[model samples]
Target: MNKYLRRALAPLAAATLGLTLLGGTDAVARPIGWTAAWAASPQRPSEGFTANWAEQGFSRQTLRQVVRVTQAGEQARIRLSNAYGTSPLRITGATIARAGKGAAVEQGSVRHLTFDGRRSTVIPARGHTASDPAQLTVGAEESVTVTLYLAETTGPATFHAQGFTDSYRADGDHRADVSGRAFGEKTQSWYYLAGVDVTGGARSERPGQGGVALFGDSITDGFGSTSGADRRYPDALADRIDRPVVNAGIGGNLVLNDSAWYGERGTARFERDVLDQPGITTAVVLEGLNDIGFYEAQAAGYDRPTYFPAPRVSAAELIAGYRSLIAQAHERGVRVVGATLLPLGGSDHYGAHAARVSDEVNEWIRTSGEFDAVADFDRLLADPADPERIAARYDSGDALHPNDAGYARMAAEVARVL
Candidate 1:
């Protein structure tokens, strides 16, 4: 056996991932149940990897965002977040629909969304709200569009920096517009929209008995995957399985430290992002690369001189972070699946010392048996000849992220453990 793998493979052998994690509606079992079909961990507005509307905020503009849901349902609800807002977020109107090309929506699929029996509501600073359920039949892996009309001068918006799909903008109230023509401007980040939940018989078609929440960083966020392709490993895994898979990945996120560019550390946000998610029976964690890579990249002069507060952490500390997350997940009866950090050789994030720390972490993830299950991605993606760098076929041009094919393999490896 590889030195990293445990002598006893009992945990690794549970490929079917037998677990009895389920939720009851209204604090009791009901015919209709809710499942988080899609999700995005919120991040504080800041200068990010690309141009976005975070700093400028929005005023008298309609924002249309597209997201892919991994579960099926005839009735759905949306969650909006102002987790980082300085003042209350005033929304004049909102709508949800089956997405058409670009900013457009499928005719007749559009549903007006109301919050707490009202068409409009205010989300207090650092708060969020969920819309009343709207009727709209949808299938697994369907793309949904959410349009919000911000009639007031909303201060800096809380958003997900790497949405992986185009978000359209129009100058006025276009909440009910099915023809995307009025929406001219676009960005690749999600503004305010946090999650999409589904319930009803249509969910019977979901791949499995319950949903799996992917809690990780950029790799899980599908950074290098083609925009609008929905080719993230989570998406690919949702395709292969019979259960819903919601992504809680935030690009550039860390396991041990909070970030202005990224979101909160894993331990700090685990409850809201993972535990609080509806019908989350399992959570797969694959983070910590940033905690290990941040300082070395800065010292090597890889740019982002302004990205300070870059605290260096030891491998042991990173392992402890994982332990904290694992304990929390298990307490909620959510099975925890741990993934090895990917090979980082030849990237700006890599140095001799950084490589050692990554190796130490991966070894523990594979052999420690703390996680209910393990997906050995390092062994699966590492270049056989080099053993330290990612295989050329899997490495995106930047040497940091994976291409679509690489994401596919990751999904396959994860499915084996699921």
Candidate 2:
């Protein structure tokens, strides 16, 4: 018990510990990095695929996206979507492989994917399925190419980029059996692929995890980021942060309840859109203007357009809805950040009506103090003098969605808050 006696025994204890290290039977599991994760924003067609529209362009083709992995690990999952295609979207074959060498089909490793019941089958449109977690290994900062072989086409596709992006074109038709055709990668094009949901770590532990929930309209759904660009604001934010981003933005989604655009406002779907996320920690909301514009139109004397009219939501109503949304999110411990409505002054989609409603909503978002934080997408990309217009510099031609540069600006501004 004496200090000198204890000190004398310390070396014996230390030596024994070292000897145990050499012969001990105990083993520790390596930490596998697995943390909370979510997709940035999700998009589906306004209407699920129907037989009538099959002639237009309804069909399930191979949908793929490249996931850039930060640290190599041994387990992973794939979040496959049938969110927009009509009819059950079936997957004939799915695989994850290392990026191919060049224009050739490069194969590194392969894994089979399954649906609710079958390995090769269809997923109901507007529904989703996550592949069973698989055991595999990847390297630090490596890229995994997830490729899904397509079945027959039956409905119009709700692809990643609604606008335009550079894509490959084969000389002859190449949809039926694309087994050995040489492929091309357009470095500067936009891609319709949503995102890759992955899980990994060292040892038996999970990975360091964080996630982003992208809540907005079609823009957040990635309408205009360069095709294959993978540069939606949410994607941009996700790539910069050490977190998984899941996009919940649906085109034509409103903030207040409405019969049009899927029978309700974005709020109605929040439970499914925001709460249902696998592991969401941070969420960014960009809505309201749609409600204001659409509702206000009917209120005015504008006849229900056999064609259409401008948006008509009132400022007070939109603000109140936002308040409710904020309160609900806080209750769930999810940080809700507001996004100012972007300009649509020149959009042929809506006349001046939606633009005015947009102005009212943006004003409230900037001044209301109703959210945990605000992402001023309007200030970042709007025309300074007009305020109602997207800066000519940032407009994506139609003047509704932001161009690549415009998206970049929006992302940079949002990143500041995160």
Candidate topping lDDT = 1
Model 2, 187-286: lDDT tens digits are: 2211223334444444213322334577877777677677655676666776666555666776556777643333236766665456544445567888
Q: Write the per-residue lDDT of candidate 1 for residues 1-418, one digit (tens) a residue.
A: 2111111111111211112224666354234456788988888988655679988899999999999988888888888889899999998999999999999999999899988678999988887777877888888889999999999999888998888889999998999999999999998999998888877645544434678889999999998998888998899999988788989898888888888778788898887787777777889999998888887888788777534667778999999999999998887778999999999988878997789999999999999999999999898998999978899999887777888989999999989999
For candidate 1, which ten residues in a row score worst on lDDT? Answer: 3-12
Highest TM-score against the true fold, candidate: 1
Give the runs in model 1 whose Cα sits over 4 Å from its true position.
1-32, 201-208
Each prediction's whole-model lDDT (CA):
0.84, 0.55
The C-alpha local distance difference test score for the whole of candidate 1 amounts to 0.84
Q: How many clashes in each candidate?
A: 5, 60
